[model samples]
Target: MRPAIIRKPAEQSVTPNWDDSAAARAAFSWQAQAGELCGLPGGGLNLAYEAVDRHAQGRRRQHVALRLLDRNGGRCDISYARLSSLSNRFANVLKGLGVQPGERLFVLCGRGLELYLGVLGGLKLGCVVCPLFSAFGPEPIETRLRIGEGSVLLTSEALYRRKVAGIRERLPQLRQVLLYEDNGGAVDTPPGTLSLAQLLAEASDDFAITPTTADTPALLHFTSGTTGTPKGALHVHGAALTHLVTGKYALDLHPDDIYWCSADPGWVTGTSYGILAPLLLGVTSVVDSGEFDAERWYSILETQGVSVWYTAPTAIRMLMKAGAELARRHRFPRLRFIASVGEPLNPEAVWWGQDVLGLPIHDNWWQTETGGIMLANTLAMPIKPGSMGKPLPGVEAAIVSRDEQGGLILLGDETVGELALKQPWPALFRGYLGQEERYRRCFVGDWYLSGDLARRDADGYYWFVGRSDDVIKSAGHLIGPFEVESALLEHPAVAEAAVIGLPDALLGETVKAFVSLKSGIEPSAALHDELLGHGRKRLGAAVAPKALAFLPDLPRTRSGKLMRRLLKARELGLPEGDTSTLENPR
Candidate 1:
């Protein structure tokens, strides 16, 4: 089948923030975007002020900033004014506790008012805010805190008792442990922890933000490697520009749009788009405090009246597995634009969104290191189902392979190579914490090597191949697992697929795929051969999978990326390093 092109010229009525792609790229500048944010009172830039304080002090003061939903069908709305005041009080609380500027303040909590206030307040106080997922076990939590040298921690009372209490003595640098109030009501505070509610209540909400420059270390997000300790990616306050610009151009966020980014702040997507971008754009963002249920998600879209939604491919696949009949049960008339990240979305999921949900799901590409969206199938552009659309305005991406002298040899259109970004982009990570040499290896001269394999078409659309390390070298042919996986996904029986290369006598690496079937589809000899033959027919003999196996589910990271390396390691009796981020590893 020829690649599907989804163009929704009449999909939306409102004029997008960017309409003319060519003109937007030609007339874009980071300096011009700087003027969009309201900096501090004097001569400095602060993310918190731009995201909440500026709006609270202006006409959108009473506008809903965060619409928080609890697991048990509860709703709470916090206006910008309320957000600013509460964050101000928390900032004062941080100040009173002697947490100074540039100090690392780690937040470990779930979706609620405290998570929002903790991040914004830490930014307001000029501290480098680092947020950890509340679902993380104690070891991963302790590792990040120790690596980042966390001085203050804000978490829930239950989370503290469960995950943090055991690791408290292990982290001497964590001097201040703050516990926030949860919906379950107050419990006795731990011995070393302070109650965030009591602290906020006593603290004054009239604190002023100290002046800070654009280079001020504002946020720290830890990214773990497959075989080592997690590396902290340090981002500055200036990264807010990337978030703002990408939200406008890539996500098409407008002030009146009710947006929902179904990602947790533990991952970069949740922090960048879910929190900063939407807030900086002055849009009402919905935060759901429950785990992913297909029915609940559809309900949220309908009831919340969400206009813009940014989610992940894993979530989309799960929804696809839930069947279209369940989707038709709910209506999402308000949903105008939908985008997916965290992985290369399979084309089937994109078409499923169009056929069932009334809109095609746009796919975008970026990484933890890049910090913001580099490529996207934007609202104004025609969606090439599996393509990562085109480069964002002001972003220059190239397909390049390394030369013998360790220099970049730029490849032409339709050539698969490492995706390189010519940078000076605001959202690029400044450095990996305590790993300067490792950080330096990520770039060659001016281009940041993304380690992702991709091909650029003549029309400037980018299609993801696979990770450089994950690419299979089989019989002198370099094959991308994504292509094989995508082809497998087109089959009616396949729900999810992960392709890997295994050692073989004839070929250096042979393609092997592990798959999960749709609901009520069982794995048998006949079905297995049919799927294998389907891959061979679609992808051809050389690129197709020679071996196939059925799995109950595919393994993925906590952030929803398929962990192909883990699958390979388990299959080959290799060490499965750092299974902490794996979701319920066997």
Candidate 2:
């Protein structure tokens, strides 16, 4: 297929904050941009100071920093100044509890004002903060807490009782457990827990930001392994620099923009973009404390006047399943750009946004290890459907293959190989927690080998192939599962699909597809044959699925990523290892 570009109109062209496209050809300097981000006067760089206190103390004090939409149809606004005061009080509470700097603090709660307060306060106090998915099971939560060596836990009474109570004995290093009422109201603590509300009330409302260098460890995010326990990726406060730059260039956040990043704060995207990026840009961020509802999301976008939306492809697919007529009921005059992460956005979803919502969805790529967006379809650039666009400024990306002697050989354009990046990015994770040898395996000399297989086009745009392990080698040809899955999704009946390579006797491997049909679509022999034929016609017979199976629902992570490895395991009746991160384990 030829490259399809969605160009920006004259009137719709946005003035990007970092509009120097020529910078890509120059020697990018991290210090030049690092100097732009506000740091503490004397010395050191603090994430909290740049995110909240600076805006609070400056002219934007009265600006609406956070607009909270409650589950029961209530709205509350928090200004930068008020947020500063509240986070300061929370920091004082931590100080009064004798929690020292560099100690790990874990938060387990749903989307609410308290989660933001806890995170910002922990950063202000210079503690390594880790947010756990509130929906996680007890064992998963316990494993993270134990591995991170968390000393203090801030959670609600309900969550603590349900998920943490049984495993509390196992976490002996966890010295303090602060419990808050789930409804954002004051409540008495249980026998072993302390009341967070009471402590906040007793503590002072003013506290100075901790003096910390850029290298100070600020966040700990755990990435689930395919077989073993999750690996903790440690990131530092300097990552704020990446967040700031990406927010401006990739997200195109303006000062008056109303941004909504519909990712949970527990994930890296949720923390970096959902909370920190918008705050760092001094924009109004909409924080919805409700679950995913098609009507509710439309209403929020229309009523809140969302200008820039950062969400997942899973949500977009759900919206597509609901039909475009449902979206016609709402009007979004203020909405400009819609961006997606978590997984690759299929070309159909990108066109669906332009056809239904009057905008093309811009897809970006990054990982938990990268800490921020590495490649993105910037607002200023033309949108290439199904492409990850180009690398951000100051990011040097290449496609390289490994030689027999473990040396990296740079591949030319249109050649599929490992996607590698030049090292020492501001947002790169310092190391995998307590696994020095494992961290060493991620790098090859000056390049960090991203485990993804991709191809760079002649125009500098990068296209995602598949995970290195997920690529299929059949009949001496390599086939990317994404291309097959995307072609399947182009069919009207297929709402979701996962492609995997199954072992074959004649060929090395054969492509197999697991598909979930859209609503009102029924499974039948005729329909199955029709889908198989559709796949054969769209993707060539050589790359098309050799077999097709219909599933009620595909397994996904909490962050809305398909578990292809799980699909392959179930098909072969192999042992399903590490099912902790699965949203729906079958």
Candidate 3:
């Protein structure tokens, strides 16, 4: 929120080309060069080739493409050459199965090498790739299959049985199902399923990459809607280029940096950071295939020599509770930066990270519609606590007016309102697939209105308040959930907390909190009253929770977003839909 901090000297080494905006824009992506910027191109460049083949052609094949650690603790170091060949073989497998270009290929695998290849392979074949979380159950999986109209489903043998087995009969468009893991005992494959290994063995590992434009549909990411069905967010090849640019600035990922982004690949963060950004830049990124353990995560940094580390605020908070001494023994001399997305990184977490991790944690913000990071604190920029920093160079972010009609209107400086983008960048989604009306509603005139509420200081730094839906209203006064949650987090006993609005006959809706206590803390009536008293003293009674439920954990998305809607649904005894994204729904 202060005056713009001058770029640090070290930041210059990782800066993107700013020579000619016209030339940089011209070289945005294959789709832009192919004429998709003005109108749809007849042929487009494949993003897979752009990320893999283009790097290979430029003699960057020797660079480490991926450093993968399996669930069983096995390690695999893959280069550009290996990644390209693997993708080719996978593309050939799809080709042999009669899967044509422009068809849909759905991938349902966890973090690892196979998931990477399947995604790139589908893109190389000019097919739309839909990546789903491995934790999703049959209902969520079925919803995607119905909407995606997937021609082929690729998954590990474990997830295939646990999730897809029961729903395979209902998916009419799913022609082929390929299992990546080698299961000696064959499970039922619905008559059309085939062995993925066998198919790849029969096909040549030299499938030709398809040529396309930047506008070609490369990805179909589904976002959960408050209404009926989930909407499919359509992204083109041009949007993929943003990852390469974002990686350099936001994440500070370099060739020697053993970067690790804790975000799962199923979410937008995973797609952007976990895969595309690192690969495009030829960085040696670490893939932690196992579960999250405070000691183990610290060990990975110490042992693997992770230079740039990125994770969520929730994980950082969890690590904070594990104490500083657990990491004191390790020497992470190579570690340079720490970054977070998912939610606003609390100032406390940022301070603790600097005190213990030797670097300040930078917070960034973006959405599913934006293919890459829009607002961020770059390595070159000076640290600003509790701010989402300025809009990235190519992005134009602004604060607009919230009118009486409950719609976004244009606003000037220092005013709090809805955040909107003045122009669509290369990474921005074209539209919601098959929902023209809904897509049209997202844009207000020239501005693309993001549903988040924020305020910009006189210096242009954007400060996040909360999501519009999560805003609390009481007695004609408006309050943000972050303000209240941040207050609650200050209490030593409160490990985590989520605030939501509940129906109140007197005040339309009153604030209610579901709290999780720190380790060894018990739920006591005295403690509840103490927390309420603390809230009254710290944040005023107007923002205090009217009712509090001490829970073990909050229902959150895999990306670590508190799912207040799900909690509200449960409190009202309403049927909760597609909690597939929920990490701990109970």
- Cα lDDT computed for each candidate against the true fold: 0.91, 0.91, 0.78
List the candidates' TM-scores in order. 0.99, 0.98, 0.90
Instruction: Please list all clashing residue pairs in model 3, or write none if there are none.
Output: 30-214, 31-213, 31-214, 44-212, 44-213, 45-212, 45-213
Task: Please say which candidate is ahead in TM-score: 1 or 3.
Answer: 1
Query: How would you encode candidate 1's per-residue C-alpha lDDT over 1-586 as one tens digit per residue?
Result: 5466556556576887877456667888889988898778897899999999999999999999999999999999999999999999999999999999999999898988889989999999999999888899999999899999999999998899889999899999989988876875665787988888888889998878978888989999987546688889999998989999999999999889999999999788999998999999999999999999999999999999999999999999999999999999998888999999999998888889888898889999998889899999988877888898899988999999998999999999999999999988988999999999999999999999998999999989999999989999999999999999999999999999999999999999999999999999999999999999999999899999999999998888888888999999999999888877877577
Ranking by lDDT: 2, 1, 3
Question: Model 3: which ten-residue window has the lowest total lDDT?
Answer: 33-42
**By TM-score, how accurate is candidate 3?**
0.90
Candidate 1 has a TM-score of 0.99
Model 2: runs farther than 4 Å from truth? Answer: 1-3, 11-13, 23-28
User: Which regions of candidate 3 deviate over 4 angstroms?
Assistant: 1-44, 182-190, 225-227, 402-408
Report the poorest 10 consecutive residues by lDDT, candidate 1: 2-11
CA lDDT, candidate 2, residue 42: 68
Cα RMSD, model 1 = 1.1
